[model samples]
Target: MTRTVLVTGGTSGIGRAIAARFAADHAEVFISGRHRDTVEKGAKEIGAHGVVCDATDSQQVAALADRLGKVDVLVNAAGGLPEAGPGGRSALDGLLAQWHASLAQNLLTAVLTTASVQAKLANGSSVISIGSIGAERRGGSYGAAKAALAAWNASLSAEFAPKGVSCNVISAGYIAGTNFFRGQMSEERHGALVEETHNKRPGTVDDIAETAYFLASPGARHITGQTIHVNGGAFTTR
Candidate 1:
């Protein structure tokens, strides 16, 4: 049977790639984004359903849950580093804003969306929350949020495992072909990031998409409550 899948922040980059991968396999995919145009465009391009809903907003998330009564796969891929706060703010205020925004975007978005869809997750459902390699080191506010995400995934797995559902986190490294840097990363910084990886090359969105696809497959049914690293050995686990 074709499974129903929901991917948040699926308008571009890693999220969009994941949505496309599943759509190509003929899954009933629904993608969400904060903008109407991007969501519609992405949905059309990938032949998946589109919903303009910010996962960070509770009301919008509730409406999304209503629209998707049940889902077999839920990919929480909506998150990114926010630029500085509004101009003319004190350093402390700006710092606080950055932290709050990071938490809301990276951590709370997954929390709220999953909570809203708790009941809608069918038996044997799979939940994959996208994390960052920044959580390992020098991530600053964004890293903190991602660290908390992995911690939450542990608890989430325990809760869902009893119901035969799998919940895990995909700790991704520096992936190319994404607007993640937003044209802010210097060429030197990019090279440094790539050099840090064992492969000496940046990752691709497809690498992550394939990993997610496997985590939801029957073979991965035995895997749960784990953080799978896909960062080309950038951050090795002991």
Candidate 2:
């Protein structure tokens, strides 16, 4: 059967890479971005469908689910360390804004999207949410959000596994080719990250993309409620 896949935040970075991988396998893929032009362009290049959506918006997520009807694979890839917004009027307000932004962008986006589309998920379907290495150490607000994501995925997996669906999180580390650093990555910091990895290398978008592909495969049907780390051994779980 030709599967239907939906990947949120597929305009660039890890999301785009995952969408492209599935598209190459000839799946009927749908790629979404917060902007129309970027979504359209990404869809065109990858030979997949495109939709404009901010995954955190309930209405938009609902609308997207209505359009999808039945999704065989759902990848929640809409996340990042949110830019520090304009300073709040007060120190307390600023602190609140930063944490809220992190949770909304990283955690709630997946939570809302999954809830909106839960009914549409086909039997034997898979749900993959992108996570971060920061969740393990020194992540601040962003890391906390990803840790929450993993927790949520665990609960989601338990709920859906009985229905023949699997839910998992891929915790990525120090990927080289994304706008994730917001152009603020210094050479010293970058080198330090690579050195920590047992492989002494930065991860790539395709690394996560391929992992997403596997988790959706029949071989991984028994794997659920788990967080698979993909950081070139930067963080190990034993």
Candidate 3:
């Protein structure tokens, strides 16, 4: 059976990889992005359908849910570092703006999108959200938001489990191929991150995509409400 899979923020980076993996499985894949051009290009490249919707916008999310009909899998991958707002601001102002932006981008985007599509999720369906290992060690607004996301997923899983729908978070670490660093990371910092990993290497987008595919597979039906860390042993939690 060709399951319908929806991956938000799938225009690039990890989300794009995830969509491609599902498409390769011959699933009916759909990718969402804020830009029409990017969404069309990504969908064409992966042979998946494309929808233009900003995950953070409630109206757009509702419209997207309406357009999707019923979905078998939903992947919330639309999150990243907050963009800097207005210029020449005070230190305190800048900090507050960043904090709010982080929460909105990292936390609320997933929350709103998932909530909007909750009723559309079929029994035995899967809902996966992309998270970051930064939530464990980093003490910043982005980390805080991601931590909150995990907490929320725990509750969401419990609520949906009875209906045979599973919910989980994938906490990724040191993944490359995205504009995550915004060109500010130095070679020394990159090297240090790789050294910290037990494998002495960074993760690839395909690594994440494979994990996500497994989680949504029938074999993982009993594995809901869990945070699966895929960081090359960079950080372990028993």
Candidate 4:
């Protein structure tokens, strides 16, 4: 049966690919981004409905939740690198700004959006938040925020598990095809990242999208409060 799926930041990159994957499966997909033009364009391109809402803003998120009815799968894929602040700033101040931006963009976006749509989510619904490998290594402020996201998801899953809802985070590694690098990633850096992966290749948007699809499937109902790492065996805990 077709499910109602909501993907934030679905206008581009991994989020867009996820939306397209669901749309191809004939699911009713609703995508959101901060830009009206990009949102509409992406929706049209993927054959999914689009809405202009910034996941970082609680009010906009509430409006978005209201716009879309009950959602069976909610993918919080709205996050990225922190924006550069004022120049000539002290190291401590720079770090603080980056931390705040990372928390706001990566962690708080999911928190606010999920909270806004909590009531509308159906029982047995799946909540998937996009995370990064940085959370586990030398990711600095960005990684710390993602690590916080995983912690938060654990608590959220426990709270909502009784209601039959499942919550999880996907810790992705070396993923390409997104503005993740903000166009600053050098070819050498990219090559090094690819070389670090076991597959000797960069992760694709479809890889994460397919995993998300499975997590939201009936077979994955028993899975909750877990962090599924999809890094081409680049990093393994087991």
Scored by lDDT, the top model is: 1
Residue 230 shift from truth in candidate 4, angstroms: 0.3
Estimate the overall C-alpha local distance difference test score of candidate 1.
0.94
**Worst-scoring 10-residue span by lDDT in model 2:** 82-91
lDDT of 1 by residue, 1-238 (tens): 9989999999999999999999999999999999999999999999999999999899999999999868899999999998767899899998899999999999999999999988888778999999999898999999999999999999999999899889999999999879998888888998999999999999999999999999999999999999999999999998
The 10-residue segment with the lowest total lDDT in model 3 = 176-185
Estimate TM-scores for all models: 0.98, 0.98, 0.97, 0.96
Clash pairs of candidate 2? none
lDDT of each: 0.94, 0.94, 0.93, 0.92
Better of 2 and 4 by lDDT: 2
TM-score of 2: 0.98
Q: Number of clashing residue pairs in every model?
A: 0, 0, 0, 0
Give the runs in model 2 whose Cα sits over 4 Å from its true position: none
**How many backbone clashes can be found in candidate 4?**
0
How would you encode candidate 4's per-residue C-alpha lDDT over 1-238 as one tens digit per residue? 6789999999999999999999999999999999999999999999999999988888899899888778899999999888899999999999888889999999999999999889988787999999989998989889999999999999999998899999999999988888888888899999988988888999999999999999988899999999999999888887
**Structural RMSD, model 3:** 1.0
Collision pairs in model 3: none
lDDT of 4 at 139: 92
Which residue runs of candidate 1 sit more than 4 Å off their true CA positions? none
